[model samples]
Target: MCIAVFLWQAHPLYPLFLLRNRDEYPSRPTEPVAWWDNGEILGGRDGLAGGTWLACSRSGKIAFVTNVAEVGKVPEPKSRGDLPVRFLESKKNPTEFAEEVVMEAHQYNGFNLILVDLSSKSMIYVTNRPKDEKALVSEVPPGIHVLSTASLDTPWPKAVRLRTNFEKFLEKHGSGELPAEEMADKLMTDATKADKTMLPGIYSVEFEHSLSSIFVEANTDQGRYGTRSISAVSVKTSGEVAFYEKYLEEESWIEHTASYVMEQTGTG
Candidate 1:
């Protein structure tokens, strides 16, 4: 996922809410959101790597990851997509699992991972590419947060715009339910290139014009590149979860929805 915004413990009906845009080359093959027959996790699978950028288990554990943008960074042998998949499939506590990832983070390309245990009301944010070579992990405080390619809450134009829109949406709805479609619409809004100003380290004129918006469309050597999916999840305090996702399927844009009620024991 290139852009993501999440609200934790900020709603009365929904204890957790997530909206994210997965941007990539349009030609990449992918399987939309579904339960893997081999595992208990639910997510859209990356056709090339067989791992996922985001996923959630029936046990009420959620994970999402984004690549860290840095020019000329050497590619790692391990796939960063596995970070979220491994966490969701494991039995470790959020903190413990994050620590385990930190130890091996350098083996994979740079990435930011967010892990949430809904039943326990805990969230961990970890990243392997700090300004220094070391990793950083923290128990995220309850509120809204934005993550993109630069780093966690890096304040890039697109990230800031999306974060502000999210906060305003919550403020306007306050205690009322937000329609799933509207949430998806918010994620699809476009911010044209002229609206963005270059920030020295965070962003520059070299960024493709398509990247100025939450949704993207750019021409690259690999063909057309763009936002492939806009996915959102709503989790009630009682553990009822609703997932809404939109992506291109067979050359047409399609929306998919699924729901799972958490088991009382926090086990699928």
Candidate 2:
């Protein structure tokens, strides 16, 4: 399972956002995100890689994609990450954003993608894994959205315990003043401490408690800010293996986190 959250923040500002908890297991060769050899991220793979679960650019655009591998579905290529990234670079609104992918899905394999653009103050979700192209704009009364799976929000009996309080946390809250480390810790522990429903797959060697939590502010100087992360993996503990999180440098990760912040804060 792969998941990510974006948070917003203040800065030189192209609508900044922080990306926390972007963890995933890729196909062995890994899906590529751009044109290689040319130094462009156009969706290629390095042996079934994952972890590009969420990303943002200085342009105030955030995007993430997850593979829904099924037997009957078309064979996924080793270079599907490009689809999400491409969507990020394109589109101006949630509606246009969602429609483009549905219309052009033949260019890649099947997957679910969420795109957030602060420039237009909009968000959209698209998936081609089903028989039809499914897309939706972010809206109220939708509750916590769970993608790729049958249900949204915690589906397990144990996780169901914390739903009520967590929903309140997401609703009543605005930008946080908590320190980065503290917030991250809270995001990771808050779910478990209150109950088991903070996140769907919060416990596993593949999933660790390392990522503390992810927080983002939706309204800012440019209406975007974000921080913290809830990413954990056993491979990083082994020392021999290297696990890479998205947006390590440049203007990339900043936009990613700010996005989550925007989603949380909304355009208002």
lDDT of 1 by residue, 45-137 (tens): 999998898899988899999998766565655888888899888998799999999888778777889998887888998988875454488
lDDT string for model 2 (102-181, tens) is 67665555566777655555556666654333333332122334332222232433223324333344445443322333
lDDT (Cα, 0-100) at 137 in candidate 1: 88
What TM-score goes with each of the models? 0.92, 0.48
Leading candidate by TM-score: 1
Off by over 4 Å in 1: 131-135, 194-196, 199-204, 265-268
Every candidate's lDDT: 0.80, 0.38
Off by more than 4 A, model 2: 5-20, 24-51, 69-71, 76-78, 106-110, 130-180, 189-268
The 10-residue segment with the lowest total lDDT in model 2: 233-242
Candidate 1: C-alpha RMSD to true structure equals 2.5
